[model samples]
Target: MIDNQLGIRKPRGLTAALSILTTYTPGGGRVPYEDEVGSDGLLRYKFQGNPQHYTNAGLRAAFREGVPLIWFFGIQQGVYLPFFPVWIVGVEAEQSQVAVALDEAQRSLPIGGVSSEIERRYSLGITRRRLHQPVFRQRVIQAYESACAMCRLRHRSLLDAAHIIPDRDTRGVPAIANGVSLCKIHHAAYDENILGIRPDYVVEVRADILREIDGPMLKHGLQELHHHALALPRRRADQPDPVLLEERYDRFRTAS
Candidate 1:
């Protein structure tokens, strides 16, 4: 990991070089970066490029074993602010290897008392991953037939399995009944209280949003979505829990 405390700055283009959110780059190769993996399975990333030409072999070993590694982001500058997990999917060359993981797993980390540098970083990373586990998200996505529950947008990239009760809540669990697939736009609107989903699976726009006479984004995106029934999962077992949705909707209504 590059530590900014020692006055060491990260080299350019490093952030674009690694990602866990997508497996393959547009060029169809793995992400390019140099990091060392100890026998204990911890990854120590120091730079963006593998100047020693050992990255290919190391990544190959990781991919072959399905090993997960913690990627440490640069501190102090606030670029790539949080540490997250990554899997080496493919190793194209000494300088090119593909890595992928979920960005959601990197967000909303809780800060607390630290026993050591290692414990502080690793504990939060593990907690964040559990909050947005891939298995939970995939179950909700498949239950919705890979379409937005609100707008029915079928594009997988734009879709997200949003929580009816946010993970910050004590009752929020990574269950299909606590989630809904929504496009990125609608998800943001829902989180901001511009839109709300009722317990009966009906969607509503906030009264203020309904009164706005704006452009296509507002008209089609938020205003026109009032009172639309959510596109539900086929299996009743996978559907959003009415009790949870009602509780969340009550919060939305109060916020509006």
Candidate 2:
């Protein structure tokens, strides 16, 4: 019964079908809103001013020991409503705590739990196609032997499997034909439309970048790649699809 004094408002009908996972208490008052989540999937909550308070330390330990923590949101009508409980799994320090929601099946799937509830409404073929993404990067990286298609950078840690058409697009399939292994720098440039790849696999720097007399990173890392063909996969079928490349290249061209 710690007066954390913050609350998370759940959307209407969010707990309607997932009631089994949610916990409710009547007149629980307001809960704190200071939950900070990171890209690495660690959600942190600091126990206000006295972060090392006994209660905070105890709860942090429980969370790290896999204890389920009920996230209370305040009372609605005569009942205290809370969202689905999350399993506390990590404690970076006595004051900082981390936890993940209890949705094993959904969490294990790709794309941050697109929610089977929502995805069930889509066609089976679409769902099945999207599900293959967990293995998509592996297949693409293997095809390129973990090298960047643009600069032939061989550092696996700095490489990414990029999509010709964004993964969110309806036409973007999780097949090797729609993927290219690129280094982190190239991926960012591609995403920002500062760099583009033609349908014929030739690289192109945005017109503005080509004109800018910048440093070595800009000149050699980007401009030098202009008109150079992407280092394609050894297997012809693993090469990026020309149609998808054309579609994406059009967007990059428009941005440039």
Candidate 3:
């Protein structure tokens, strides 16, 4: 809330584009400039179509003054994730795009560009860890239609995107095919190997858990899911990869 501005679409105190973040082509239409992020931990935001555009000037003002702004990154239709107080770290006038940084470490680097190879590499590593999982979760949840694969629960808040392969593994790319939508309980069970999914897309409960006498959660939530076919996405590409599923399932078998 800079300069008493009522909306985010305007400049704040003539210094910053007040929380400047824009989504393209969901409902309004395609944006003339396509923005992209580089592995260098910098987001190259496309310049405005008009050289004299007020917002472009506003962005320049923000860059000059080192003001903070919010970046509303759209992950899917009707869904946006807000990254607040991001810095206008650099302005590449020749390239017609500006560099934005997501973290303080990156923001503290050189004024015009990425500072050093070591610092940049570290920044990139942190940026990936910060951004990719949330985007991955959104994609996975969208594929599953916001329902849990095990219980078919449709509550959005209860849903989570569980990784088929752990992120530490080389093969654990943040893609829909490498993820599964589960409720919090099932997600915990999957992580603990208390429950597992076969490559065939069938659910399985651990032998000990299956035999144990417990509450309804233990019975219906875990046991009843045994032999149940995991709900899958309609699009084959968005469905979990069987090979990855098998890889993760192996761990579950071992742990169980």
Candidate 4:
């Protein structure tokens, strides 16, 4: 809906995918351009924009309440070029609004400096990667608030945003409700199928593994987590989707 205010009209599929991605990484800048010929004989527009200018005020407000940056790109074409969406990556020169700069590498090459093909590739890759990173990390962190859901540990550096649903299954898009923040040890345990979380936010430890005669590793590492409630976000809106939690829990319960 906000896109409408900005006069950006994107295809449904592209918009849905971009929404999932921007929910994570949110500080990339964007540039608007009129069709101009580059030295390389290819028609490519330079990107220029200040990331700070493009940040959503509402989202920033959410960030103040502990929500992470969730930036997105909205493209509007001039008379000659068609409008399409692209993700903003790095800001150029740290400007406060959108700014444009020529691609030096593209300007140096033999084919008149610009590679139309490469530009297209860059457009898609930047958008995709930026979007995925935040969503994936935020979802996991939201569930546990960068603390280990199992052990209730709260070291930012030591915690990992773990995905309950694999990225591959979701086309590499990290949905917030599909993640949980865990410590490195716990993340590995969850990934390795040694531990799991229930839909009701309860911890689940593998019985056979816990009963093994190995050192107190299993007992101390996992059994201690049983019956513990997950560390949740301070704000209800920051919580991961209940449906996603249920789906992951169902699969994990069956496997256990």
Largest lDDT belongs to which candidate?
3
Q: Extract clashing residue pairs from model 1.
A: 20-100, 20-101, 30-97, 30-98, 31-97, 31-98
Candidate 4 residue spans exceeding 4 A from truth: 1-131, 138-145, 171-173
Task: Summarize candidate 4's per-residue lDDT along 1-256 as a digit string, tens digits.
Answer: 2242332222343312112111122112111211232333323222222223232322223223332222232211111111123222222232222111223232233333344666645533433344344434544564455677778788878888777777656322354445677889998988877787777777778777766776677678777887778777665544555676677767767777
Q: Residues 1-256, candidate 3: write the lDDT tens digits.
A: 3222222354445655766554422222332112265556566676666645777777787889988887765556556667776878877788777888777877776534445777666776666656667666776888798999989999999999999998667667767778999999999999999999999999989999989998997888789988999999887767888999898899999998
**Winner by TM-score between candidate 3 and candidate 2:** 3
Q: What is the C-alpha RMSD of each candidate to the true structure, in Å?
A: 13.7, 18.3, 5.5, 14.0
Cα displacement (angstroms), candidate 1, residue 85, comes to 8.9
For model 1, the run of ten residues with the poorest summed lDDT: 21-30
TM-score, model 1 to reference: 0.55
Provide the TM-score for each candidate, comma-separated: 0.55, 0.53, 0.71, 0.50
Ranking by TM-score: 3, 1, 2, 4
lDDT of 2 by residue, 13-125 (tens): 33211111112221122112212433333334554346565455555555445544555433222233343454445455644543344343323322323435444323233
Best candidate according to TM-score: 3
What's the CA error at residue 188 for candidate 2, in Å? Answer: 0.9
Please state the error at residue 184 of candidate 2 in Å: 0.6
239, model 2: CA deviation in Å?
A: 0.5
lDDT to native, each model: 0.59, 0.60, 0.74, 0.47
